[model samples]
Target chain A: MTKNKNNILSTENLAIGYAQKKQQKVIASGINFAIKKGTLNAVIGKNGIGKSTLLRTLSKVQKPLEGTLFINKKNSNAYQHLELAKTISLVLTERVPESQLTVFELIALGRQPYTNWIDSLSKKDLQKIQWAITATNLETLQNNRCSELSDGQMQRVLIARALSQDTEIIVLDEPTAHLDMHQTITIFELLKQLTKTTKKTIIISTHEINLATKMCDELIVLSENKIYTGTTAALIQQNAFENLFASKIVKFDRALQQFVIHSQTF
Target chain B: MKQKPYLKHFILLSVLLFIFFLLNISQGSVSIPFKDIFTTLIGNTDVKDSWQTIVLDFRLPKAITAIFVGSGLSICGLLMQTLFRNPLAGPFVLGISSGASLGVALLILGSSVFGGFFLTNSISNWSLAIAASLGAFLVLFAVIMAANQLRNTMSILIVGLMFGSLTGAVIAVLAYFSEATQIQQYLFWSFGSLGNLSWSEMRVFGSIYLVGMFACLSVIKPLNSLLLGENYAKSLGINIKKSRIIVLVITSLLTGVITAFSGPIAFIGLAVPHLAKMLFTTSNHKILIPASAIIGGMVLLICDSIAQLPTSEFTIPINAITSLFGAPIVIWLLLRKKKITI
Candidate 1:
């Protein structure tokens, strides 16, 4: 693969997995991909297929079992921990620990990497937090405690927090995992708009392949013991969605660009 | 406008704490008048010598201890609850107190089995403090190691509980082998006392508590990030392992020192942080840390005042007073809120 100057993140022969003492479990290997700047991308795979693991590795929260990852034309390993935080922010699916933090306070936490040792927000930090809240449409709920928000609203708060981080790249793990159909679509649209307006690369691992394929500029499909990375339409032409779920009951309809029931047995 | 309620609560609590501090010093065993107490505090020779001695030497040190123990344990509790992300977590939940208790127990009880030299010779308070700190540090080291090895918070909690029970069993065995006098001494130590601290001990305790408070201040940012979860905290550039170690060290120092001096005073560490969170209505540690410390100090002052039994010459054990008062508030808060969060 050619190294594109526009690429914000890329992996070469990457192997992602967990390693214990004298034992290694390779979840996926020989992976190669590049994510360009200002693009919305999605990693879609079946349940328990290492989508989260892949995201964790890319965000540098976990170490890749093998191979190299490059961010902004430099080896990812060379970036200091604080520098990496400024380059890539992440939103995970884990429940926020029980907190009475208001939406504003929670979003301001995103400015942590930029804040001084005391973690006080300056005028510039406050402006960034306000922008994140406004962008995520959380203006009205700024004072409400995080515990009181709906799952969809909470997800947005998490996104706003990532926005406050003000990183060049934002990665989310199943950002819409527990949302309704409408909320999920809204989140996808929000992510797309964020990428376009902020010119920040946004990558999300999601199970909503149909929506992702429709909205995302790029799709990374994990299937058939391999990784497929390309434009959504190009991946569709390559029939990358065919083996997403190796089951007879559900099938990906290339024509309709959605999944359909193969049989009326149910 | 957004910070109005928090500021109001802080002012209210601070005023209450001041009143409680005055009440705590004024109505001790001899029941000195508030005016006399004030005069004594400001270096006025008009106050009676006995009143001055009681106020300056006895009641003052006890009140100061109350403040240190209250603030230190509450902040430590807040740190633990956030680190474990469990509502039930507290300063003692990680067995730091148990470790301290074990140390005290060994000194008091083990002397019987080992020829009674240390106890008969009158072991110094410094030795006891050092032993308790060492025990607490050992447990803290073990917990940190387990935390690094296992990512599960619940497992770490269980491991801590196991260490507590294990220490408890050792204490029990020591009790079994000890004479009744040694057992009585050990029992008295277990009862917890805030008034026994000398002015010199208070200075040492105060400085250590200050160090722990400073540590708490340094980690407030990371602690706030942790409210979202470890993954989110890590994404925010928090070194989770480092934060965990710092929290443990601070907690151990606070709990160990307090327990060494006061014999594992309970309830304040477990209850004060929740009270602060409820009153402030925010989990931002910038507010919660100081708020919890103030409230904790106030609560302990109230408890200490009641334990003094102002009207009567007889006083009650502070541990009993704290449990009786604090346990109910915790229960009421839990029931009223119907949910508890870190």
Candidate 2:
């Protein structure tokens, strides 16, 4: 719990969006937030919101439209591409192209930043890969081809790949976007455990607002053309969830910690 | 533990390659005995003079050509497949061979159109090789330009295909008006001749191929990271643009050089990588690159041996022979895999 006192990621007056040659489209502006070490943070919003753009900007996969973003108290842009890779790992939503690669080979690729030019894994590198596989409960599936894995298992393997990266933070986009409720909960629980046990910050953008409120250490709500950042309890007390949707058909039920549809008297 | 399987496969492939190498030299038109072939290879004077000339002069360079062309094309195919993340990608998929053919076609057919007497056999083989390289380089340059302008790999692939068809159309037109003898020469070149290279040409081929192979070795890490997808690869600290350019350059060098010498030999580039993947059951390029090279050499040697038709003096064209053997394996693999994800 003491690790939460240290900030691992922070953004100030950040503008997120796309920029053409002469025109710029800003999704969200004046966003200020800090992510603590060893915490699981979820960014949740309705569809077409700028959750993904914000994540991409923070990760430096795409440049921010305006303002400053910092990682480990240093300007994110100041870190070289290779240095940034060592500090943070990302899991994208895209399916891995099918290769004849086994789960073990796939995970070992996480050591690329440290591996030799020929990609030979050292003893420590191999041990880290082993630890990642074991931590993710992928020992039995290590020799299986990635193409053979189910959706949930593949997601876990990707998480293990990030773990093997041995970075200070992990960023995932829609980690459970295509999963069943059970699988979604499993992934959320995994992230929660990973953040606590490994003392690594984890950030994810998801549409599972109810689950995020229940399990996340902090929530960043992108709604109403603004960014809301706070602990789950503080955000709820601030009535942030009420403004998340139109509140016409579905409404947030504070007491039950979930959303409910209004019953129509026909 | 992982190294053990790859090592075993490597050793198996090396053995097959050695066997094929010996077969390639010994099973030509004259069918020299193994002992005579070996003795002649080691500079002994015990063998018949004709057999010595046959083995050292003819068979040696031909077998060496087969090895380099096979390994070069297959490695280029592996690089292309990984770069594009498309299973159908090959060394020539980017129109490199078509470009080479267009060059050769222009030189051979163009000369006849400009001057009727030029077809009396004044043009040298060196000019054809240069023209082919120039043509391949031009296409490669265009592809690289398009690749820089386009971020999508599929678009680059489409542009390459279009370049190929465009070159093919030009070659068709050139072939239409050329004299019969000129057309026959171009046809012969297009059919692919692995046996015609002199020692000097083989030296050039060998050096370029070795350099390309070394370049491939340097990029194994990036290539393996790329299997996940380019975005994931970039996240892993791979410079995607740099890797793509390096892969394209190496692929272009290998495909262009071999096409210059061998005339766009078919199917080995496309099929041998798949063969290596299925046999090895791993997409790790560290293993696949060498495996494909060895398997490619063996496949080409086998094809070349069959092309020789040991009983007759007339040998078949290597291009036709490769398609004969390689196309069916590719088709079968496609049918068997059902999904072309790789």
Candidate 3:
């Protein structure tokens, strides 16, 4: 149960799962982690290891099954939905349901918290949206409908939406899902650049251990028994990732800092 | 955003709506001249008494009713499309019209249940309207309750459809046991109308239409947010439950009130929003709401004009004209675009 003053977001004994028939279906429990400001963090784990659950819980999309979540050293529950929205934003795995929206309009929607009731974008709102479009390198595609864009371009639109929100923390779930290697590496590099340039904290849940270890400043690896949070070098030194796979399929190579097929497989 | 293209389209549509308004009033059974309509529309007594009565008492209200029904149902359709995130959704998708139908069916065909003596001779239009409203609200209430219990918004769409089916089944049962005269009366109600409204009914219909329009305008921000999907909408601080209810209630209110006054007029609500989407090539509800309203009124006015069949005594039912004529035009527009999307 840690709530450090310097951390932008932290958890205290958090438990996460859906409530089925009034019974808590706990997927992960006794979880604890804190993210500092302007840092790029990756929550990496095996399939169904509750990476999305942790991100969703932290973004306040769902209530924690137990314990507390703090945003800026304050109890998260004390913040209003709109207030919290001004502090944190999300890019989720769900596709934009309506495909007819233009790229500019879609990104402009991120200013929902700041726009007036009629949702007309003010000068400041337009500037932020333009900045996000430029940041995501989507200026050429701003006029195109989202349905017309490729998956990689669409992913950037989603990120632009979060960027336009101008929040201190951006949480992305599978930001590179369904994307090619070049696109995945581009997204990872973009996120790193964003955190460095804008001083915004970014947390992403991903299966790309190589990219996580290479690009992210910190890693929150979800294991079955407990959660581990540390710098990649520190976690590697602690051997915190040795049992993450719990499988014989692939082994983590210390020198390469990536997982590779064992030579004995033949 | 530079909305120049649609701004031009709006202006053009507004001008066309005005022409259609005049055209709708002139082409009815009496065939008044455009000058007399202009005169009668303003405070002029120079027109003949017969022309004045036909234009003022008959054609004017019917034309106004056409505009209200068209715009109201179209707005309802727009809201439904955004709410459900399904292009096929329309004003009656939630079955509120069927609820209205069941109410009329129970009143006209439910003689077995309500004792024919009291309601048989004196089923005033007011009572009929009241019954339709009650039936619509009953379904509306049920849908709202169901929406609250269900976490998924798409599930609410299913719940609304289920309510439609449930009420539809009841109406079918009533039609099954009813006499030919009663069934025919209910059938006439279903065919829909625009010319039968009195001034008092217009006042009631117009007020409810305005209220629904205002509520629809109020939800523009949330509606825009909703285009991304619910999770993104929630992240943007939209109260999902509140926005959902407001959308449902406004859609129900507009759809129900229109059905109450004019019967279950179909096709326009479903087709007009698509027309707006096609014309504008944009999904921003800020433009969509008003554009649908204008195009809705224009389409219905045109259809109403065709139904009246200038220089003929026989009149076609508005519903037959709406689908018979409107469908091909929408299909043509879609075909020309070589694509379709909400």
Supply DockQ values for each candidate.
0.64, 0.64, 0.72
Expressed as tens digits, the lDDT of each residue in B57-89 for candidate 1 is: 998998989998898889989988988888788
lDDT of each: 0.87, 0.88, 0.89
Candidate 3 lDDT, A1-266, residue by residue in tens: 35456699998889999878878989999877889999999999999989998899999999999999989988999989799899999999987775578899889899999988888778899899999999999989999988889999999999999999999999999999999999999999999999999999999999888889989999998888778889999999988788899877777889888887765658
Error of 3 at B154 (Å): 1.6
Which pairs of residues have clashing backbones in candidate 2? none
Candidate with more favorable, higher TM-score: 2 or 3: 3
Q: Show model 2 residue runs off by greater than 4 Å.
A: A1-5, A263-266, B1-4, B116-120, B333-341
The residue ranges of model 3 lying beyond 4 angstroms of the native Cα positions read A1-3, A263-266, B1-5
**Would you give me the overall lDDT of model 3?**
0.89
TM-score of chain A of each: 0.98, 0.95, 0.96
lDDT of 2 at B232: 86
Per-residue C-alpha lDDT of model 3 across residues B235-310, encoded as one tens digit per residue: 9999999999999999999999999998999899989999888877788888899999999998899999899788
Task: Output the worst ten-in-a-row residue range by lDDT, candidate 3 chain B.
Answer: B1-10
lDDT score of model 2?
A: 0.88
